[model samples]
Target: MGAWGISTFDNDDAADWLADLSDHQSLALVRETIAAALDADDYLEAPEASTALAACELIAAAIGRPSAAARKQETLTRWIAHRKPSPDTALIADALRAIDRVLGPESELRELWEETEDYAAWQADVVQLRSRLSH
Candidate 1:
């Protein structure tokens, strides 16, 4: 999945999704991405999982809880600065649920990470993202 690290935006799918998000600057896109993961009835693909995580990162940033890596993303930072969106409680709660689905057994992202030595670190990164959304 072209992953270099465990941070939400440290992968190809997420990077691409972030680029789209930056260009469009649409909160509805963010909601749709998270819902893609949260509402999936079958096994979730790695790319979809990655995109959802990126969407959750945006939600966290909108709620004034950006991760260190998120702050370093120039495009995302610019988008956030431009939009200044304030996510409500429902979106945050859905983000949290989307995170859970990404980390769940049906997620191909989690399955792929399980085969790597960095599995724990990847899981930790996702948990940290969830923590950011929780508050």
Candidate 2:
């Protein structure tokens, strides 16, 4: 959990995942990441959760609702310019559902954040991500 801030792409896992996404330029990776989180039957790991959130952020960007932080990332910006992903409604719904799972009690990422004084801030970031995905 190499996190500097609570924004979607602020962790090592997310950054690495984004790099992979940029390299592959595949929207299926984003969908798969979100599905991984949503399909988890046991406790979701922090890295998985982080990556899912990053996937959600990508979906938001595809729909012209990128967060300020996401818009600043060179790789993500470049990927968006090149791929031009147009996420369907199902992907958006799945991203939203994955976000819910990440925020839920069974999530290691959520549990880890609960121990910090910045839990509220982290939660707010997730809520903002969900909001962005909603539209």
Candidate 3:
């Protein structure tokens, strides 16, 4: 139910734990939940960390942390594939860019940003980026 250090997988237990606590406890649980949500094994349906992040947004009551833009990008990628992004995506993207200003840019954050949703798509992009960057 929990992977205390993984941000992308098995987050329900962490979210449940986080939801029961106060702001003080929330800070710590937020870290755990985010990590769990990032773990590669978190997805059983969508392959992306977005589902687990939905849990983070609900129970953690916060979205932008660490690499906020990248996180939002991850979520948006999922939404875009579904057809269209809601207005909320823009809100989250704005918040994430603000966080990025404080955190500096997290280049190569893709290492932690890939989703499990579709390996072919991800792999192609990775290859493209790698080719471009390596040149």
TM-score of 2: 0.95
lDDT against the true structure, each candidate: 0.88, 0.89, 0.33
- Per-residue lDDT tens digits of candidate 1, residues 3-58? 66788888999999988886675688898998888888879999999999999998
Of candidates 3 and 1, the better by TM-score = 1
What lDDT is obtained when candidate 3 is compared to the true structure?
A: 0.33
Quantify how close model 3 is to the true structure by its C-alpha RMSD in Å: 13.2
Backbone collisions counted per model = 0, 0, 15
lDDT of 3 by residue, 15-100 (tens): 34433433332234334433443443423223223333433333212322222322443433333334332224433443233222
Question: How far off is residue 5 in model 3, in Å?
Answer: 28
Model 3 scores a TM of 0.24
Error of 3 at 10 (Å): 18
Which ranges in model 2 have alpha carbons more than 4 Å from their true place? none
Which 10 consecutive residues of model 3 have the lowest summed lDDT? Answer: 98-107
Stronger candidate by lDDT (1 vs 3): 1
